[model samples]
Target: MQDRMTPAERLAAVLMGQKPDRVPVNPFILGFAAKIVNLPIGDLYADPRKSFRAQLLCAEMYGYDATPMYAYASFGAWEFGGEVGMPYEPGQSAPYIIRHPVESPEDVDKLEVPDPRKAGSIPIAMEIAKLCYENKMPVVFQAGEVLTTAANIAEPARLLRWMIRAPDVVHKLNKKVAEFFIAVAEYFTSTFGADKCMAFTGGPVESNKLINPRQFGEFVFPYMKQIHSKVLGMGVHVILEHPCSDQNANLPYYVQLRKELGWNGKYIWAFGPETPLEKQIECFGEHDIIMGNVDPPSFQFKSFEDVLALCKDNIERGIKNPSGYILGVGCELPPLAPPINVYALMKAAREYGRYQ
Candidate 1:
């Protein structure tokens, strides 16, 4: 462990299968910090300065290695002129989905990929990335994955119905969505440069707990593979896939996909609490970094001591293999999670996280 190293260097070292000063800590910021600072979510999405300030706050306050510039809600569909209705509670957090477009197979043909630089929330994201680059802060920009975007466009429930009732149409829609995702990535890379931004972060929410692995392979994997290959080709450092469920069964397939695409294991296969760590280690190997198994609910509701103990145990387990692990919540840290617990988790990673 080097005594003096910059956050970006530490992160880059870890991703390159090398030991850093300590395990890099990355926490997902879900635009709540903007609200905390009395900035509306919409405004945060619209103004790069506001978003950058909020991200800097999270990094400075929480000691996070990277600042995630995530959009307020899902934006992939919105680019295609599809309507998305997000319901927010007054005092409580947790976004509720109220509406989406793409009701029938005919709807797929109507979809046209929008210019990411000019469309929906993407311009705002690009601006924020530019600001982060100017400030020399490592930024992790979130681009919705193909399958996740497809699900977003055709509301989850409606897509599920289509999977069962109209499989062919579902495949066509997914392909169209995947193509759009590739275009978006190309546009972002062209604007921000592949090295300036961290890998794309978004969920493949259509998998496992929501649908089986067969459906995942059919609707999710192909598109994800396309996006992953493109990003890898551009020499991107990481492509963190967020699938917040027990995706152990899909591990082998993910590994195979990486092999087929000739991807370095630096990219993350971020999993939920239900994923077995031992199995992930065995399947993905010692050099492949894994992120998150800590359940967000536990950290939010449990005692700090309990959270510390869990984090300590996880760090110990991770170092058993060495240099290829990160400690983070399975999903975004709940907005209400105790700041002390978050600090404790980071502290545990610093003290107990080591490569030998």
Candidate 2:
């Protein structure tokens, strides 16, 4: 059972289209890292030094095969001049927007791309990115998808209403959000060199549970096209797209977007649990690296054996992915997830995910 390669080596092999000794367990660990180091979830975001430390410490503790990364669901509010409420309570996992910057249609015209170097969590995130770079790891940046970030800047319900009543305003806001995303990419490219950087994005707002496929085409596709095209143009190594939750109805549009942008193998699609692995592989083909779909809530609520069963099933299919496969949690690991259950993911991978 002894490994033939280190975690870094295994990850590099996959990234380079080479076979590894086994499937790598890249847990989408966030606040869980803080828990490992005995820091409150709030410090995980408010203090870059501590955040970076916690992530590394937790990864070392679990012996996982991925580098530390910084990201949060509520990404845009503070960056675009709104207030954010950092999580300080026991069960709270991520920060939330206390006040959205845009309250009305008029505010959309007032939007401007904030300077990435000094903007909200960018500075804090940059601190972690630099730490990763200095330690010879990929400089990770969470340059979120356009529609989701725009929703954070305004509000989700407001954007939904606007999508029906005032489509023009939604487009205007998305344009500005796209610009901000591009600007952040530019900054990361300049600071860390494009080869050393990795962009992380997620699409929770565009989930079928939130909007239908038509809404995705109308509001999500165009700006996502622009963001992906421009960010890839910056020559970053890869963009990890986490299409979170119930996106089966909108999966084809994602394939279409990739086709339209000519991004054949430029993305790493980490899907949520609601999307089956068979469907994900069918949609993405043998071009992109497929990362995940393990139901994350199980870590907090289920037994270790139950968690192991899920990981085993995911690996059985995911290991056959022609392009590549990474064993990862579907979403961020819940802060309150039992330690033994979290360990089940790695245990299952080691037992059943070994490459022939």
Candidate 3:
């Protein structure tokens, strides 16, 4: 029960389904903290040192179980001229098109995979990984899943349309994207030790609310399995399949996939406020780690009391499996979330996250 557990010890304990001294909190810091600390968001995708300093500072100030030095945007499509727009605010993560470049079946044959080491923002991300590793902080490297990457390349709306209009093209594109991401994962893991690398799949590919079980099986599941298998083959722990919508209906599919792929339930299936904790815990059971559910809006617009209440509710939902839970905002923390509210989340985690 030592408070000074090594990062490896803490993470290994969690992955092994054992209680550590307390639950781990691994929230991605953005918005106000970046500005208050004077870390510019624009530099995050371009400068590894700036990103590393900001992330390390947040980890030091807030006390997280792990440090994740993530590029603010996906490197592949961004480098290939994938319709990305400026941030909603001056110091926020840049927003990309709901649509993509590979709009038609013909576009699939023309899509080129960007090399991770040479791509637009990937070198910076890799450099950040080196920085985090040099600092001796465990780093989780976030990457987009095949579907997300495909969506990024062809735009989400176009890809969704292609699912029904041109399923074969969608399948081909996803396979290519999956393979590309695997290479990226391999490069980073090899460069910065597998133990320090955690692969992140962004967006809601597994959500039944967004895509049906049939669609997921055809378009999403295979690519996810490929990505997860590739990462595991490289001896890296693939942490979160960040599906923000309702995954209850497809939880069985994920559970079955994990069994087939030999993934221990220790891998995370992160959710947001939209995913009720009762449903998530009931569907996935005690072995699974639930990473999110605290509404970002509360942190952005609500009172500290309200934020505390949200934290308490999320924690209470996983009280029976404290070691299998992480305290975090439903998605990226809003750029304007109050520092006190952020601290409130950490305090609640400390108070309620104790392993009895």
Per lDDT, the best of the predicted structures is 2
- Work out how many backbone clashes candidate 2 has: 0
Candidate 3's C-alpha lDDT? 0.69
User: lDDT by residue for model 3 over 1-356, one digit each (tens)?
Assistant: 23556545666677777777766776656544465477666554455677677766776777766575664433346645465553545545654454356766887888777676776566767787787788776556655666666776776778888899888888888877877788788888888778777777666544676688778778877787777776777888656767756666666667776777765535776776777777767656555776757887778788988888888788777656543776777777776677888887778877877776
Against the hidden true structure, what lDDT does model 2 obtain?
Answer: 0.87
At residue 209, candidate 2 shows an lDDT of 88
Alpha-carbon error at 43 in model 2, in Å? Answer: 0.9
Model 2 worst lDDT run, 10 consecutive residues = 258-267
What digit string (tens of lDDT, one per residue) describes model 1 on residues 215-289?
778777777787778766775666777766667666666777778876563667577777767777776655567
In angstroms, give how far residue 113 of model 3 lies from its true place: 2.2
Candidate 1 backbone overlaps, count = 0
- Could you give me the TM-score of model 3 versus the true structure? 0.88
Misplaced by over 4 Å in model 1 are: 1-4, 35-46, 71-73, 85-89, 92-98, 354-356
Ranking by TM-score: 2, 1, 3
Model 1 lowest lDDT segment of ten: 87-96
Most TM-score-accurate candidate = 2
